[model samples]
Target: MSLHFDHNRPIYIQLMEHFYRKICRNELKAGDKLPSVRETAVEAGVNPNTVSRTYMEMEREAVVVSKRGQGTFVTEDQSVIQQLKETTAEQQMDVFLTTMKQIGFSEKEILDLIQKRLSALENGGDSNA
Candidate 1:
């Protein structure tokens, strides 16, 4: 698992997002055991305490199940995974909309830009117009 850290946000939140992406992409399957906290911290170059906190938060959210004397595994709930995907998408959309508004983009202009980008992406990144 590879994680990229941005300086502006909390490392734990970024770690959570990284895990979400991995789960969504099937890189980490349900019931797959995650790396040890120390291992992940070393790999990600972050404090071990931060990695532990991220794991703890994931446990609290039912995203992972911990086995005593074993390790932490991804939860085996497809519904929860789907919900995570939807929640991530919604959060991204909210950020996009808020940023557009802050940049003085009118709703119509934002919608038009969305249409243009969607069309281009749907057409394999070739201009559709």
Candidate 2:
């Protein structure tokens, strides 16, 4: 519940990413109710308005649904959840690839490095070795 905010970005966007991670990891499953805006604001140490904006943005993205009386809930559509997972993976992979390229790693080198790391992990060796 304690979220570290990135001062370079909008808090609401960060909050949305937090929830996206939770959902992708199944920590916040489909149809699960999200914390109330005030509760989330207090937990994240942000203004309630920020939390409200986060929820509204999520709603716009079809990530969650806001009912008239009930609180916001995670989307029940399995396709949405699957898409979220794939999208998150892709974004992370993009960052990884860009960083590796910036560090002068070739495509084949990156692939080999990833394979070696996986092999090491599978053999119960230190992956960072």
Best by TM-score: 2
Error of 1 at 27 (Å): 1.4
Model 1, global lDDT: 0.89
- lDDT (10s digit) by residue, model 1, range 1-129: 456778899999899888878988889998899999999898888899999999999999888888998988999998888888788889989999999999999999999999989988897877554
User: What would you estimate as the lDDT of candidate 2?
Assistant: 0.95
Q: Candidate 2 lDDT, tens digit per residue, 4-117?
A: 988999999999999999999899999999999999999999999999999999999999999989999999999999999999999999999999999999999999999988
TM-score of each: 0.84, 0.94
Lowest lDDT sum, 10 consecutive residues, model 2, at: 120-129
Clashing pairs in 2: none
Which portions of model 1 miss their true places by more than 4 Å?
Answer: 1-4, 126-129
Compared with the true structure, model 1 gives a TM-score of 0.84
